[model samples]
Target: MFGWHVPAPDQAMLISGGKSRGEAGLPFRIVTGHGAFVVPVMRRVTYLTLSLMESVIEEACVTQQGIGLAVKGVIAFKVGSDQASIAAAAQRFLADQDRMSVLTGQIFAGHLRSIVGSMTVEDIIRERQKLAEQVLEASKLEMANLGLVVDSLQIQSIDDRGSGYINSLAAPHQAAIQQAAKIAQAQADQAAAEAQQASAQKQSEFARATAVKQAEYQSEIDQAQATAQQSGPLAEAKAQQAVLEEQAKVAAKNAELREAELVAEVVKPAQAEAERIRLLAQADADRTKLSAQASAAEGRIALDQAIIAQLPQMMQAAADGLANANLTILNGTDGLNDAVAQLAAQGSTILQTVMQGLAAHHDVGQQGGAGDRTDPPALGPGPDDDAAR
Candidate 1:
């Protein structure tokens, strides 16, 4: 185990030895495995790493513009994984593995100078990727000879010695960008101020409108309250008017009833009494008229009977008077009878006149009185009648 060796995953182990040193064509074999053994007296083992490596180069090179430019760059490389390439690398660097980075940097430095010298200062500064590509292409074959592969090359910076060329190139574009930024900021500020003023105006108008509407509502509420307060008094006045109207109707009915009672109690009895008195007076007047008519008829009958009785007496008296008258007898007995007849006719005439006077006086008395007198007047004796007595 003392002479045993194991290689890492990224390394190769080489064994070189023989019994007498040249018995087997310099006695070398490459081993890539976990472990390998070597006899201490007959063989020797060496380990070679197979990892990626990086190198940086800084050099002053002259460009095609006849200006000296400082070029700085980085290169990445690795030992090839093929057997021949690995064997070539192991033979050269097995004694000192650190020499791989130094050799790679020297190779990249020489190629970077050659590529920069073929271009102008502007191309080296602006087209740095093109410069790196050309350097990598040129260094490819040389790195292969050293059992290396060039993975990438990068040109970091290119500068002229203390010249103001780069600042002069960027001046106009920088000034244009600053001017555009100032214009955009001024436009944004103006738009924001206008929006703020419009919002304030709208808020003020809304507040004023709300206050006016509220005042109108309050006025309506007050008017409604006033109307409510007066309703009770108005209703009471209407009720009083209705009560007075009912009382008036009752009084008028009572007056009509009193008028009817007066007509029945006073006027009706008076009218009946007046009618009774008028009938009694009419009856009395009729009785008086009938009584006067009856009396007048009885008196007229009595007077006619008395005048008949007196006519006989007056004829007798006339006969006596003729007897008493003495006369000579010229014709004897015939002449005396003629004188008696003449006297008798004269007495009859007087009796007729008296009866006529008595009837006339009775008629006069009845016409002059209102049923007071209805009898005939009495007659006196005639003048011839008294002489006879």
Candidate 2:
């Protein structure tokens, strides 16, 4: 393990001298790809680092326009990883690996000068990529010979050494660009201002419309609330009206019932009573008339009987008186018969007068009795009865 050595990933290890020093032989080998290897005694091992690095080149060179321009640039390079590139780099930088960046910088500087000499100052400043590309192309073979790969070349800066030629050359275009930028900025500001004004106007209009709508809605809400507030009373009024109407109907019904009851209880009974009284009065009148007629017939029969009884008594009396007086038949048969007949006629006339007087007295008594009595009197004896007996 004393002769065993390992190389880093970015390194190539070279083994030399199996029998001779600083020589390539059977024992000499290049080790890469990061692993351990054997190094025999009396052999040398050299490790070459393969890593990316940069070099800076600053050179004052005269342009094709005869202007002294200082060109500053950077070159990114690395040691090549191929066997041939490693072998070539190992031969050149075997003992001095730190000299690679210095030599690369010098080489890029010489090429940068050559490239700047070929182009104008404007080309070196404005077309820095063209300058870098041309420099890269010129330095390519030289870097490859030294086992280096140039990854990129960039021109960092170009100076005109305080001469105002570059500024003078750029003045017109810079002024034009500044004018165009100012115009663009003014236009943008105008557009922004107009947009802000429009936005403000729109917001104001929206606010006004919203306020109006809210006012209208509030008014409607108030009206609805008022209507709701009045609804209870209105309903109560309607209910009261209905109640009153029902009461009126009941009262009317009561009045009708009362009228009907009066007709039944008072008017009908009174009418019946009046009809009964009229019937009784009519019956009494009829009874009175019949009783009067019966009394009149009875009186007539009594008078006739009285007159017949008195006629017999009077005839006997007259016969007695004539026998006591004297001979009264002067002319015998004819005169005597005429005197008797005259007496008989005079008796008949006096009987008629007495019957008339009795009839008148009976009528007067009947009238006096009727005037004194509420009921009809019963038929009894006549006034001429005592005289006739």
Those runs of model 2 whose alpha carbons end farther than 4 Å from true positions after fitting are: 19-28, 34-41, 229-389
Against the unseen true structure, what C-alpha lDDT does each candidate score?
Answer: 0.76, 0.79
lDDT, residue 293, model 2: 61
- TM-score attained by model 2: 0.53
* Local error of candidate 2 at residue 197 (angstroms): 2.9
Per-residue lDDT of 169-231 in model 1, one digit per residue for the tens? 556766776677777777777777777777777788778878888888888888878877887
Q: Which ten-residue region of model 1 has the weakest summed lDDT?
A: 18-27
- The top-ranked prediction according to lDDT is 2
